[model samples]
Target: MQLVRWGILSTAKIGTQKVIPAMQQSDLCEVLAIASRNQATADEAATKLGVPRAYGSYEALLADPDIDAVYNPLPNHLHVPWSIRALDAGKHVLCEKPIGLSAAEGEKLLATASRHPELKVMEAFMYRHHPQWQAAKRLVEDEEIGALRAIQVAFSYYNVDPKNVRNVAEIGGGGLMDIGCYCISLARFLFDTEPKKVCGLVENDPNFGTDRLASAILDFGTGQASFVCSTQMVPYQRVNVFGTEGRIEIEIPFNAPPDLPCRIWHEKEGATNEVVLDVCDQYTVQCDLFSSAILNDTPVPTPLSDAVANMRVIEAIRASASSGKWV
Candidate 1:
């Protein structure tokens, strides 16, 4: 494939404002078409985003032979279903995070992706592709943080729109499902292991019937990862990896800025060091990596199986919260 022709499944804000523009910046791919529930809406997005084609329905976009791949930014509940539909249509997929509402649902989607081995399916965890994260991983693996002991991550933002899809529980709305997944994913990435046990605490929004504030502790045998995520708290994001000999702190860990340098602070034995990374767009890196993988028959950065593993940990956390005990 000289260049992958891409189609977007929804006119989601994240697509219009972030990923699409980032993908457009990648030389390996071109976003040719976009779809929305309404024709006018799709057309508006196409014109605004400079896409060449617009379809009123997702199925129409999937049917277009010109589209070789799809970016599924549909709501959480629609992720697996729409991704499966695109896969059946012979289009590779890059679905947004938390690919399913639960582990069982994620498993079914994973099985579907498995059957279509010719196509690539990846979860859109844009952060993992950023240089800052890559540097952090190298430092940890190099023992710059000494022997990793624990990890701390937090991602939160205040969203009070009751009518927004994120505030509706019936559609898989919650902090844990929304931003909390970042904490869980990063923990697993840095530790390079899965948790043996977990515990959690969550406070729900009675009116919305969704978790507003949540926290979890994942015991990874060799280390422990703890995080707090909230949709009703002050906006903040940070990650810290603690080791027996030192620690590394990431200021712009998750939602890194594309226009400014990102840095990691390391402290050890009464000394400190800072690693500076150039201004970079993680979404662009993510799209380019996936496109290159597809073109060269290499491996994607974040595969569907990895999403299933993260979902399993997420399910365990929810279970622990419900039972008020370790799970």
Candidate 2:
């Protein structure tokens, strides 16, 4: 099997602590190098993650002729710029979620990708690769829940660190960009289409100047999806899909633990059935799928256009919040 040689663009915690390790376990991925602004930091991360090479500058990593792809886990503001650079350097790109600071920025990356027909570009929404989500989608499509009518999601965590990237405002730090994007993506994913309209309510933290709490209702015509996400609330995450005759509840939807069996409850006609999935690391699944696409000349699981669409929803929700009207 030919493994894709991957170079990580940063030592971001999500990559070093979760994604890189998971990719290391993949048969289709080889984490060849890691890069950082500082040589020492890059070296430390490369050694810690067992990557073979370390580069002080992102440009150096991008210039590596052996690298087939780049995993960009940079901050929200840098996602597009670096991903575009990777594409220009002749490498496929798997960028972190909330693809860019706004829909316009995501479109820029999409445009750059279009100019490079040979390269694959994808926004990493790792949760979608989890089997639990796949099962949930199957159940919805199979109508085990009888025509899907609604989806309610609640994802939150208490965080107030002023210096944290998620708390900063200028560089696209906020609950919506950081976590709420997942909620919007979920609605589009389950519905298999874009929302007709959306209304949102946001509460910004005075100190951080970033939204600490947000709730939105996405009108999907056939059904509706509502979600509330917070950065200053109890740590919890869940999703419930309701239909005319039944419903499905995902027990740990977003952060599905790799070590524990995941479960989804299906209730119909007052009878509940539990569907349990074997332990699996979603990141590993995500890595292999992206790698396979690169090796096989196949489409990525999620396209650059989808990333732009998700960003448009996010922008609309913010617009709705400000204008006090559906958008």
Candidate 3:
């Protein structure tokens, strides 16, 4: 496959710590450009990541004729616009999760991307690519857990820093947007179907004016998924799935940092079967998949079409919590 030259749209912490490193490590991709709202930061990142080009503005990177793909690690508010910009510039995009404020926003972005047949836009949910998750999916399909019927996923971390962007609603800060999204996204992937309805409860922080903790129940066609997430709690992440005859549990960080290792348990013939997977870099897998989609024109794993479904569930959760009634 021909190398896809990648341009990162920001010097965000995730970009510096996960994505840039993964792209550099991927043989199918190259870190061709780095851009930031700040010129000095862009230059610094380009030098640090060994990217060949640096730009002070997002548009400058988009205008680069050589850039085949773009990574939009910009803040949540800019996700849709920047992704649209990249698509219009004829570049495939791998955008960070919560790519829109609502499902409608994601739909609009998808529409914009659809106009560019030569381009593809995908949400960056790197955990889905981890070997641990792959094993979990195989176990589910193998009926190690019998016919899957229910699931529970949780991801929370205490970000007590008052100045952190997650505590601010204006910048898309909240439990539902920050960590809860993992639960929602995972539910869709685990169930392999969109939730028909959702019920939720939210507890907002008095100091931050954002929902610091939230929980939701997703009603799939044949099963149910319960999700709990927070940004003002002790760090925790795990997933459990139950079926008619048995169950499976993946005990580890299920999202956020990629390449997390997890253990699975299966109940068969009145006995418990368990296995642990080796830790793998989920970010590298994510980059690998994105590059494959670009080079081979294969369908994106988590396309904007499906990502919008997760956003809709989140919107429903927010509505249910705010209205004190099912949405």
Local distance difference test, each candidate: 0.93, 0.95, 0.85
Give residue 203's error in model 1 in angstroms: 0.3
The per-residue C-alpha lDDT of model 3 at residue 294 equals 79
Instruction: Report residue 119 deviation for candidate 1 (angstroms).
Output: 0.5
RMSD of each: 0.9, 0.7, 1.7
* TM-scores, each model vs. reference: 0.99, 0.99, 0.95
Question: Candidate 2: minimum summed lDDT over ten consecutive residues — where?
Answer: 42-51
| Residue range 1-327, candidate 3, lDDT tens digits | 589899999999989887888778888989899998879999998888788999999899999999999999877888998899899898999999888888888998999987987787899988888877787788778887788899988788888677877887888888898778888887788788888888999999999888988998889878999988888888888888888888777777454344445567767668887777776677888998889987888888777888898888889999999898877
Sort by lDDT, top down from the best: 2, 1, 3
Model 3 local distance difference test score: 0.85
Model 3 lDDT at residue 149: 93
Clashing pairs in 2: none
Candidate 1 regions with alpha-carbon error over 4 angstroms: none
Provide the lDDT at 131 for model 2: 97
Superposition error at 133 for model 2 (Å): 0.4
